[model samples]
Target: MRKNERLKGKTVVITGASGGLGEQTAYRCAASGANLVLLSRNVKKLEEMAESIREKYGVSSLALKLDISRHEDIPAVFRAIFEKAGHIDVLVNNAGYGIFAEAKDVTPADVEGMFAVNVVGLIVCTKEVIPSMRKRKSGHIINISSQAGKLATPKSSVYSATKHAVLGYTNSLRMELAGDGVFVTAVNPGPMATNFFDLADPSGNYVKNLGRHILSTEKVAEKVVDAMLTNRREINLPGWMNAGSILYAIFPRLVERLGKKAFFKK
Candidate 1:
């Protein structure tokens, strides 16, 4: 089938679709003729976004108020989606948050909150979708990780740990689902021009320092949608940032020595 034809009439469920990367990905998928199941904690915003997408792209969309961090809430939300949309051809685990603080400074709540949304939440969502995908023998699971997952920085230790867990899980899931015809992809993007940094780095230093190197949300979203349609296993944006991952893997100590100053600098 043709690339554009691949997503036409397909059902795509995206968590965190109220704004940022999730919102952008929803637009991209809608343009490709995919029916969108948009999930977010903010019901009003999600409904507004869904209406806009439906109007602009002429694709059907459903907005569900969801808190992915609340594992107990996922099953019912997904059940409603399945009842409304029938089946999901693509699942984007895009709802996650970060708390950037020194490992010692991060509170217990901080650790729990981050893991709840980033690691455990993603796993639960994946589990919810896997059985149906397995029975059908075709599906795509796109996980939005981060460059931090590949290379742990100073203040982003906990956030990086969560993403690393996501990367590890995605890799293992990919192999397990390979024979079952389910494609799993991990997207490791560098910083993007999004509000994520407002929460991740409230002091604004990280964004101020890295603003010039950041990718736009639209650019990253396009790449993500392309990966979905083309079945790419992994996507690392702004090649240079991805290079850092490679360097870290091959020369951890050397890379750390060179990066420590900048990574920890205020």
Candidate 2:
């Protein structure tokens, strides 16, 4: 890899670093020579993952037990990263949860909890990091959104809303920081086989069929790292996802109609 292409010697902070895309991205970033600050609510898993990265890539890493749902935890974690690394070159806001339920079936608490991690928490983390980035006039902020960010799917009403908020936030923030040299990007992925399904509504078939077309967690991580290096603004993995976006944009009512049809058939 070219010097600019390599993540070597950079300090990156990744939330939701315990499993799935976060875990895979941590390992890949370490291999590319980026020192990592991995944060997740699962302390034991985070420690184990940190050890694996160190052993394989010989890169130093720190694991912080974090619950992105709790906004109060942001300041302290940001302080630790700043103190330890002097500056955070990249911030990957990947720690988010999803709740799969029809709008009527969704409770207020369920919606609130998802937003706490998926939208508000991401915003809070970015807010905490921006002062440093603005001072230096350089940094990368990568948010892990979803295909649902671009289109709504049945039973994903609340989840879709949160991701859509992320999409809007990323765009607006990117523009505001454009001249400041702070790059803000959003990574929107389609179906992926992860424990995300385990957290979704149990009766929902959304995960069953969708998970069948899932991409590998490692592939998603690689794409994320590539996006960071290239300074991409918005990325939809696997190409077909862009097609999905186009389809949704061109045929808004089509999805709702087809969704209801599919529901009846089921």
Candidate 3:
């Protein structure tokens, strides 16, 4: 496949697509000739992006207002998308957020909110598409997990837990669907240069401390767009960070002892 041409003529559904990596990936996919269904709570912004891509890339797109936490509303939103796109070829579960705070300060509400969007919402969307994809024997499900899922950090307890759940879910889902020709992937990236920290680290301390190490949303989105329609298993950004995660997975105690200062950056 040529650069930026892998997803040509495919129908892609992206959640939280009004901003962050999700939005960037949508634009890149459109540039590659894919029709799009962009879902997010920010309907105004989503509509603007869809119209802009239609003009610039000449690709058809739809902006659907949705909050996946409202599980009851998910089925209907997807039904409307299928009505227009016929059938989805790719589903990117890229909608999630985090709050950075010490565990003792974390509230029940925070835990509930994060899990609702990060874990349950992703599973619900995946469930909605699996049946049709299985019937057709072809599809791609990309879950936007995080480095926190692999290596738990000081202030990322709840967020990391949710991502861990995503990893487990994606791994098992991949095994079950491999015979059906559905490719499942998990994207684990470290901090990013995005407004994600606007809410995640409202104090701005985390971003300030982790400057330069933060990954670029556009670059990461390009990687994601490039991996579409392929048998890729995982897209872990910034080789160095993923290396640390691999070490942590193998030598938990030793890495934890040696990385205490770094882990407390937040």
Candidate 4:
């Protein structure tokens, strides 16, 4: 099947569709002819985004305000979505946040909040979609994890833990759903030029230090959309970064010693 025609008339639900990777992916999916169901905490922004996507791609779209971390709100919100869209063909768990700090510097609330959005919220969203997808025996769940998941750094301990949890969940879910025709993929990209940095690093040191290595949202979005349509197992951007993950798994001590400066920069 042609890539563009693959998602024709399919319903794709994306969390955190208000901005950054989610927003870019939404556009890519719409261009490929998917009916978009966007969720975020910002209803007005989502509504506006949905309208823009509809206008640009001529695809049907629905935007709803949802805070996945809330947990209690998920069922009702998804219920409304199902009532409106009938069935979901793809689910993009793109809503997540990070807080960069040393382990000791991270407050209890910081840890809880990060886990709430990055791990628990993702699980809940996945739980909500599984029944429907399993019944149909077909669906795609794409998680926006990070390279940090594979290799932990000093200042990003808490955030790395969350991504690590995401990757673990994605791997396990992939196997469990193998016979069910439900695809689960985790995307582990290196830093991207997004508003994420503003939240993750207010001091601006991280982005500045990363310099020219940061990936672009458009590039990452294209790869991610392709993965969703093609049922790829995982997509890791900037092959070298992923290679580091492999090396770390094999020679943790050596990699840590050699890459400590880059990985644990202040």
Candidate 5:
């Protein structure tokens, strides 16, 4: 198959799609000739994004006001997509939030909320879509994890934990579904200048340090669409970030020390 054949006429579902990486990905997917199902808590923004994609790329698109954390709302959303698009060829679990706090300082509610949206919501959405994929025997699931997914962070302990869980979860699911012709890949991105930091604990200082190294969401979005079209097992954009993952894997203590020093300088 040619490079773009993989994504042609495919229908992709993207959560937290109103802004940041999701919005940009939707536009790119449209350019690639893919139909889109954009979901997020912000309906107005999703609608505007859908209009832009439709006008610019002439691709069919829909906007759903979805809160990923709400488990009960998933089936209806998928049902609407199936009714309109027949099947979901790709599911991008990109809806996530961050909480910058010490392990002790972050509340139980904070931890729960992060997991609810980051982990639980992703699993629920995947579960909702998996049956159809199994029947078709073809689909792609891309989990948008963080660099913190592969390593622990200091102030952002809870946020890191959720991403770590996502990394492990995606890996395991990829193995289980490998023989079935369904592909699962995790996109572990480093810091990006998205609303992820804005959603951090308002009183927390976690984002201040991270903002210095943030990548452009549009750049990351481009990588995401390219990965989907190529059926890549996993992809880390901007090169150096993947190298950091290698270094962290080979020298845990060195990475831990660097992480601590970077976030908590004396």
Candidate 6:
């Protein structure tokens, strides 16, 4: 590590650390010299990544089996984390997924499943770290929201709802912790080149239509790691898309009327 000082000695806990943005963000944190608590259901892969990080970056890491959707498991998992790490410096609630389907086609199971991991589970994880962070009056909670949160489109109603909830929660949490030094941030990224589309757009039509608009997980992860420990409010990816979101916010009906075709790409 050669004492990178950036996040050296900082304990960063990242959920969904087995792959996708979670995995990429972990590497960025390691490269920045942060000790890691990598949580995901894939213990084997997590351990392999931990070993790789230790060997490559000379930073210690703990790969824990955590299925964030299983809310009951979170408390015990976080207990083990605090016991081992003594205290957490940052918490990244990145364990989430989505499926693209029209509102009429979406099932109750789909809604329940996505909310379990994307919204409820994130809240549980954030809650687990609050007392510790508040007690120390120092920490950061970064919620991995999505650009879909800002602009709802066709065939993604449920997914957008979840991300919207994340943004709402993140905003309220940041305000609530104002007296405390703990900071909260929301990362709103557009679609990315990851297995997320494997499920979100199983038919592949959406990703095909998205084309170059799809972001690289590495790019999004770098932006996220760069904002670590800072009181950054939001990290929205792909300036153009975020700009569209801004436009959508003010003239929702106009954007919807004009973007009907683009919104139906799903």
| TM values, all candidates | 0.97, 0.92, 0.98, 0.97, 0.92, 0.97
**Model 2: colliding residue pairs:** none
Evaluated against the true structure, the overall lDDT of model 1 is: 0.90
- Per-residue lDDT of candidate 5, residues 1-266 (tens digit): 11245677899999999988988888888888899999999999889999988998788989998998888998888888899889899999999998776788989889889999999999999998888888889999999998878766677788988988999999999998887788898998887777676667464355465566668888888788888834577767557777877789999888777766674620
> Model 2 lDDT vs. the true structure?
0.84
lDDT of each: 0.90, 0.84, 0.93, 0.91, 0.83, 0.93
Q: How far is 12's C-alpha from truth in model 2 (Å)? A: 0.8
What lDDT tens digits, residue by residue, belong to model 4 across residues 1-266?
12456888999999999999999888888988999999999999999989998998898999999998899999999999899999999999999999898888999999999999999999999998999999999999999999999989888999999999999999999999988989999999999999998888999999998888889989898888877756698899889999999999999999999998888664
Judged by lDDT relative to the true structure, which candidate is superior, 3 or 4?
3
Identify the runs in model 4 with alpha carbons over 4 angstroms from their true place: 1-3
- The C-alpha local distance difference test score for the whole of candidate 3 amounts to 0.93
Off by over 4 Å in 2: 1-5, 258-266
Candidate 2 lDDT over 114-203, as tens digits, reads 999999999999999899998998899999999888977667888989999999999999999888888998999886777887787455
Give the true-structure RMSD of model 2: 2.4
Instruction: Score candidate 3 by TM-score against the native.
Output: 0.98
State model 4's lDDT. Answer: 0.91
lDDT for 219 (candidate 3): 87
Q: Quote the lDDT for 36 in model 5.
A: 92
Root-mean-square deviation (CA) per prediction: 1.9, 2.4, 1.3, 1.6, 2.7, 1.6
The reply for model 6, stretches above 4 Å from the true place, is: 1-4
Return the candidate ranking by TM-score, descending. Answer: 3, 6, 4, 1, 2, 5
Clashing residue pairs in all predictions, respectively, total: 0, 0, 0, 0, 0, 0
